[model samples]
Target: CIWALVITLLGYVLCSALNPKASLQYTFTPGHPFATGVEIDYLEPIEWLPQSHDQDRTLGAFWKYLAIVLSFAAARDWLMGASRQERRSGDGASRFPGDRMQWLLWTLAINAAAVSLVGMLQRLDGTQQLLWTFTNHINGGHGAFGPFPYRSSGAQYLNLMWPVTMGFWWVLRRRNVARRSTSHRSGGDPHVLLLVLAALTAAGVVVANSRGGFLLLVGLLVAVFVLMMLWSKRQVGFKLGVLAAMLAVLGVGGWLGGEALMARFRSEDIGSMSGRKLIYEDAARMAEDFAVLGSGAETFAPLYYFYRKKDPAWNGYVHDDYLETRITFGTVGFVIILLIFLAVWLVPFVGNGIPAPPEFFLLIGVAMVGILIHAKFDLPFQIYSIHHQFVLLCAVLTSLKWQRG
Candidate 1:
């Protein structure tokens, strides 16, 4: 299941960036197979939504998320029974440092680096692999962006990895410093590799030319600083070192690609109802009308058309995830969403002797905070890669527990 989710995300990112738009379609025709020949096995689950998703792509995303949920159930069961299996199977040694959880983190960090590298190349090489490569079909542009239609989407998607990359980088750095006379993990020289990946991820975000992404990156670093001061006060020098390393990476990255970013920021209208701001105002009105229980999942685009009178552009997303949640899920649904998904991060800190490393959960929590911050400014959830990465992070963090058969 872990692999299924990972491949699913990577495939979407790849297809979105390079494949012809028509090539990645998963038919909703009930019995048809995906373009990749895999059977379409998830229509029923997605159909359970209050209203059918208006588009095939959106419906496909819903199915993928449902698959992740089912996979999570299987993973939880396995975690519960892992102890029994360990006692019966060979190798009773404890699983720590380089276990599945750690490797998963590494996978995410590496995957992020790869994604950033592709985007960087796309920008520098002046190539467009797919139709609507840089310009969202809604908007048109000639320049190369990342795997996304808009540079901001690509930037924010990469920005979502800020915590994961930094977290893994820090973990490996600690491991290298400890040099644990007896190695508990399988990875060797991971610290340097991780540091490189972290730099790549940050550089990618910075070059995407997204003001919001830049703000999110800054916010994440501040979060790391606070976490360090409150929890790992002894690591003062380490924190400073990480900060300096990050600064150097960003300085170089900014030097290479920051002119476009500066131009983008300077070009924004200070007092104007750009389409997004207009949509936001209407979404706020929709939220008030549906304040108790949101209109419904997947209903935003269709319903937004009615509310948005000024532009009447039929915008597909609300631009702000928090507002979208409130408008779709309503107040009750919004709170439930938080409790179900976010509660895991809080549970570890709620108790002492969590058995799991607080740092692991702390990193996950910090990453999540980055998600919320980004969500506030734009609907990161509208992008499959951004949304699924968050789910994957939560699952990995939640699985790191004392639960045993």
Candidate 2:
């Protein structure tokens, strides 16, 4: 977990250091599996970096370092686990190791601890004061910008994780309910508590003020409720109504605070939209020019700086995950990367029988929704903390296996 968190933070730091404007066009590299028919370039130096404290990519280096450290820890743990299992059973390599999910949960706990530490570090150094200067320029002043140089991005990242955690808890409660339903032990209070907590979590989701996150949650809940109704689950309709109430409360609160939910959408300013059209146009044009193999891994920032005629703010990333993957990994790398996410999201539904547990679908559903949501407005996979959550979600979902034996 400690390692995972480090990876997560460092990944964010590294990604943020690159040209954010060029975010989508920068990922393709030459000579790898995806490099077929593609040309490549190596990483080059930049002449002028973005001076807007909020736009600087120094954090990208931090994220890169964190990912390296966590990778080491995961490798070490895998080896040790393999050794221990071998002592107990010769086929340990082929069999499930002792409490794989528990070990992963330990890693996740580490991630939470590490993130809290980083959050504290930012607070102590007064990074928020510096980052807030950009807040006036971002999202129409209605968003909750953090105290860092990358306030909005950081806050959005953290807020998205809240739902992922809550969804996991929902899965846990559901599994317990399934196991105990036959006994009629009146495990009612705990179930009630779970619903209450889930409601509060849904409320937090809304207060995030991120249209992407809010919409993702709404879509997820709708799907979950529909499935529940179809399955004839008792009281699920009421539970969904409560969830609706939570959203209403958040909307009303946002309005009263003068930060209405629609504020994010009202930013019709092309520049305010992060200059997305220009960025996307440039990325698409460049990718086609260098089709097959990409310019190279992490080479887009310098190229963008060189070729850019108007937008001096060009960063390496393209902002959208699908586009980033496409430009970075080319077609082959793009497909494989997408398959990873698809497999993670869809496997549970495929293998699980009819009338799947609400928890099973909801966890995967909300998580994918969060990933897809975050993907559109920001490039999170490049961030270590966000990536850590991805891996942790995969580990947590393993618990849904139908039988221990």
Maximum-lDDT candidate: 1
Candidate 1 regions with alpha-carbon error over 4 angstroms: 1-64, 74-93, 128-138, 141-144, 176-188, 229-240, 349-354, 402-405
- Per-residue lDDT of model 1, residues 330-385, tens digit only: 67657666666646564444522214555656766777777777787777887777
**Which has the greatest TM-score?**
1
Each candidate structure's TM-score, on Cα atoms with residue i matched to residue i, is 0.74, 0.58
User: Whole-model Cα lDDT per candidate?
Assistant: 0.61, 0.47
User: Lowest summed lDDT over 10 consecutive residues: which window, candidate 2?
Assistant: 47-56
The superposed Cα distance between candidate 2 and the true structure at residue 265, in angstroms, equals 3.1
Off by over 4 Å in 2: 1-127, 130-163, 175-206, 236-245, 248-261, 270-272, 310-312, 342-358, 398-405
Error of 1 at 285 (Å): 2.6
* TM-score of decoy 1: 0.74
Error of 1 at 19 (Å): 36
